[model samples]
Target: MYVAVKGGETAIARSWDLLAAARRGDESVPELTLAQIRQQMRLAVARVMQEGSLYDEELAALALKQAAGDSMEAIFLLRAFRTTLPRFASSLPLDTAAMRVRRRVSGTFKDVPGGQILGPTADYTQRLLDFSLAEPSVPAQPARAAAPLPDALPCVLEVLDREGLIEADLPPAGDPDPVDLTREPLMFPAGRPARLQNLARGDEGWLLGLAYSTQRGYAESHPFAGEIRMGEVSVFVCPEELGFEIDIGEITLTECQMINQFGGSKRAPPQFTRGYGLSFGEAERKAMAMALVDRSLRAEELGEAAHAPAQQAEFALCHSDNVEASGFVQHLKLPHYVDFQAELSLIRALRAQNPQEPTHD
Candidate 1:
């Protein structure tokens, strides 16, 4: 017998209570502390911050624990938390050239102005599982200071500019302030700057998969990670009230400069072009992928064929936001019996209107 259901509110409350209990887990055992998550689950924290657009490690750790290590879910949590945070000011765009770098590397050249500092990274380590890490070990060595900075720090672009190898910067001013994508809805046929901003906050896994498709010959573009840098860049804001620029707190950032090899065009001779990428926190892979996608989106500007999905800025940027994507995707599971019934009725009507011919053996 089909019976009308009751206690929906009570059931939902009970379910939530069960979920809370599950998330907490084993009251007898010591609860996993936020510090432990921050220190141990550092990568997860980074991913959350990168996608969430909130760079707080502690909050990210909490979100990671609360989301049970689902990077996307954690990002959603962090983003929700961030939305409630009241904003006081906007920092001026950081000049990466003046960044107090902790780590820097260049694929295009052997030695850069600031010698490559291979900071805290797991890049070279063997992927073998260390079972011994089940028991914690103490470190033996203490910290030490390094050498001084050079008078000049040369970006890879500077080298090309020196030789006059690349075309001149496009007009309309290079230093124009970018629109805040978070506050506004994404419009169709987005500009390169807006497209890049969207990709920076994009879901890492989504963008990475899209980037992989390109590598496998889906709208391919030969890309080189010209440079990747991780460092603390001081933020400044010139408030009208103050009349002078104020130095705010610094942020850890990863910047990727990509060199996309583009050949002959009617406007200019064959020359290399720049694909810029920058992201919050230490996210090398995300930054590099962002750069490649950023360059791909500029196909129209470069007079190249826009055949790839990555090249479509509207598609890429509009779907990049996890908040938007998650809400839309999960909304399908919500109560929509009325809509379903309507759809079913329409389908039944369509079938009634046109009868299919029966096939004979």
Candidate 2:
């Protein structure tokens, strides 16, 4: 017999007020506008959009502001808001070869077509904190040569494909409709499309840890960074009434192709297998981690032993969602008085019955 706890409404309202005050700390400092957050904190905005499965930068920025710069909270807010919007259309698959490449790099080849463009990366920068960023200063401009870029850049994997060194990237025969994880419950023994869909919006930190485990001999495979390209790609949607595809918009994307050496299987010869990852913006680390995890999940398909946690599709895909993980973990903070009280009563009754047996204490 547990009694219900009461008097939380007024306290909850007061807590909201306190939260608002804390979120807007130091009144003298100017408040951050959505535009400022959208532009300056573009990476954060991109991440929220990616994880939330919503492309609106404005909404993402608002979510970030409302959540006080907590990326996961911002993602949650954006995802909740996304549930209200009606789905009007589904876009055709993007063509990465035709992307207006801003940044491109490859680890396997020394001279890839389109020449390695190291656009706006912190990879070469010193890790030490730069105190100069605190003070405003005139930025220095560097001289540059104007050159027109190619319409389409050849993929590194395509080069391997020509020589019969890698497996052909072909859709399965009969080309079945892909499972939309949003509309359908994620069933076990998921195909590549469903697995990639889950991993696309999966928590970056969680995926990173799983990927790191693979490299540390959990599911060791010689992997090469075939190519990583970040740029803007056009999106197209074909409306039923229109009966033709139309260019809807363009969005920034980071695509990664990982090539892993695979031994000969019963059905095929020794060749290179591929892992792919695509993200909303210049999320190189996330994309790379996703690629590693993607490849790991394909262990069964490739006829390899699923000896590691990362290689286990069910474990990886089911736990990848941060929103689900956060909700389950945070729910513990909610009132559990009734449930605990029941357990308490049961324990007390058992102890009273066993009083003579515990007399040694």
Candidate 3:
């Protein structure tokens, strides 16, 4: 009979104390403020919020600070904290058509309806390092056009839809609302909604790699970035007390619409299909990667070959979570002394049986 013991309590406590001390750094140096992290490390915060599946910028910044800039740890921290919060009524579905546009572009078309509005992006900037950034100076304010982009920019996909060139993007009439992913494990043969949600929360690097695999001919898909846009959208929720929905607040969002190769039957003429991706902030790369993976995953529905890894639902959704992946991988650092000792004893027995066996550890 074996009994478990509560070992390493004092050492664990001391280790954490040491960690706290290390996090603070030299006492002479001023500690970092949460506000500074929130403002300055906006991209980092956005990644945490997006991957963590939480929308609070402040909380995401706090998690980042606590994790010492490790994105995986920060996402885990935010997710752990988010589990404690109570859920109220769910918000009404967002109207992307009414989104307040900040940045908008299309690779498929040279000039979209509202003209390509390149608002607050570093896409065209030269890659050379700016040494001046080390010594901070107030940067000059960017010039603004007299009339900014229109309140709601038309979607490029919608333009294709008008000419009956793109497949219709609508849900089945009798389909139920999407099941909350947190409450239930993702079932195989997942609906589009759940698949999209999983991709949205999936690891960005993993998705990027898989997306690249598709472009490299791992899967058959010729993708065109129909449009990519980032901006604010209003959220509305209707509480039990209030019969009508009330405006909550605005949240920054990035959306990507990818156009893929024609998927038409003998009855229908050749037309384009779509892949969609959306994130909490200006995570364009993530959005684009997600779009590619999403299109790849739809191979089965389109009656195309599903031989690629990206097209497999189990392969994508099960391993996409960075927090879970890191936890399982890093847990090897913890004590495995007992198991190792058992293996060692078995090895010793085998060595005793064959004295001529060379000594090995």
lDDT of 3 by residue, 246-288 (tens): 9999999999999998758765568998889999988999999
**Alpha-carbon local distance difference test for all models:** 0.79, 0.89, 0.89
Give per-residue CA lDDT, model 2, range 226-262, as digits (tens).
Answer: 9999989999999999999999889999999999989
Q: Residue 218 of candidate 1: its Cα lDDT?
A: 67
Q: Which stretches of candidate 3 lie over 4 Å from their true place?
A: 1-7, 266-268, 348-361
RMSD of each: 4.4, 3.3, 3.3
Looking at model 1, residue 322 earns an lDDT score of 77
Off by over 4 Å in 1: 1-7, 140-153, 167-171, 174-176, 345-361
Candidate with better TM-score, 1 vs 2? 2
What are the per-residue Cα lDDT tens digits for candidate 1 across 7-74? 58989899889988998888997899999998877777878988898889999998988887777788
- Candidates' TM-scores? 0.87, 0.93, 0.93
Worst 10 residues of 1 by lDDT: 1-10
lDDT of 2: 0.89
- Residue 339 of model 2: what lDDT? 100
